[model samples]
Target: MGRQVLTWIGAQAAASGRRYVRLATARDDRPLRAYYERAGYRHVGDPPHAKWPTSLYERAIESG
Candidate 1:
């Protein structure tokens, strides 16, 4: 269900001329990170300025 929602949101973003969708999650949340990975998001790395243990992920929008 979450994957579907993310896909839908990505679709909307892509339709609006966005090239990517980026997000962050706590480093300890393995399950949620895995979910995002399965949904086609790639782990980029943590932001240098973040105060917490956050993992960054980005997904490229496919051209239709």
Candidate 2:
């Protein structure tokens, strides 16, 4: 299931000019971080957004 989703995302990113994809989860989503990391997302940093902390990660698609 994860592989299928990743493949779909890759295809979507290729078709669309998506520079990066992000998911903002609650603090209690600590367990889910491991799953995302294994999918090539790195923990870039955490920045406070709105009233919650946002975990930022990115994948490069093209040169800036």
Candidate 3:
């Protein structure tokens, strides 16, 4: 059910011509990062002056 919802959201993003889905997670959050990785997100970098050690990630919206 979770995967289905994510897939649907990805489809919507793609249909809207968005090239990437961006998100942020705490750098120390290994489990959360793993979850995003499992969903195909790649860690890009960290945001500037973040209050906590937050990491940025993005997933490409493959054009159909």
| Comparing 1 and 2 on lDDT, the stronger one | 1
For residues 1-64, what per-residue lDDT tens digits would candidate 2 score against the true structure? Answer: 9868866776678679787766555545786777778777777777765477566665554433
The 10-residue segment with the lowest total lDDT in model 2: 55-64
- List the candidates' TM-scores in order: 0.88, 0.63, 0.82
In terms of TM-score, the best-performing candidate is: 1
Question: In order, how many clashes per candidate?
Answer: 0, 0, 0
lDDT of 3 by residue, 1-64 (tens): 8678778878989989999988899999999899889999999998789999999998999886
Question: What alpha-carbon RMSD in Å does predicted model 2 have with respect to the real structure?
Answer: 3.5
In lDDT terms, how accurate is model 1?
A: 0.92
Q: How many collisions between residues are there in candidate 1? A: 0
lDDT by candidate, in order shown: 0.92, 0.67, 0.90
Worst 10 residues of 3 by lDDT: 1-10
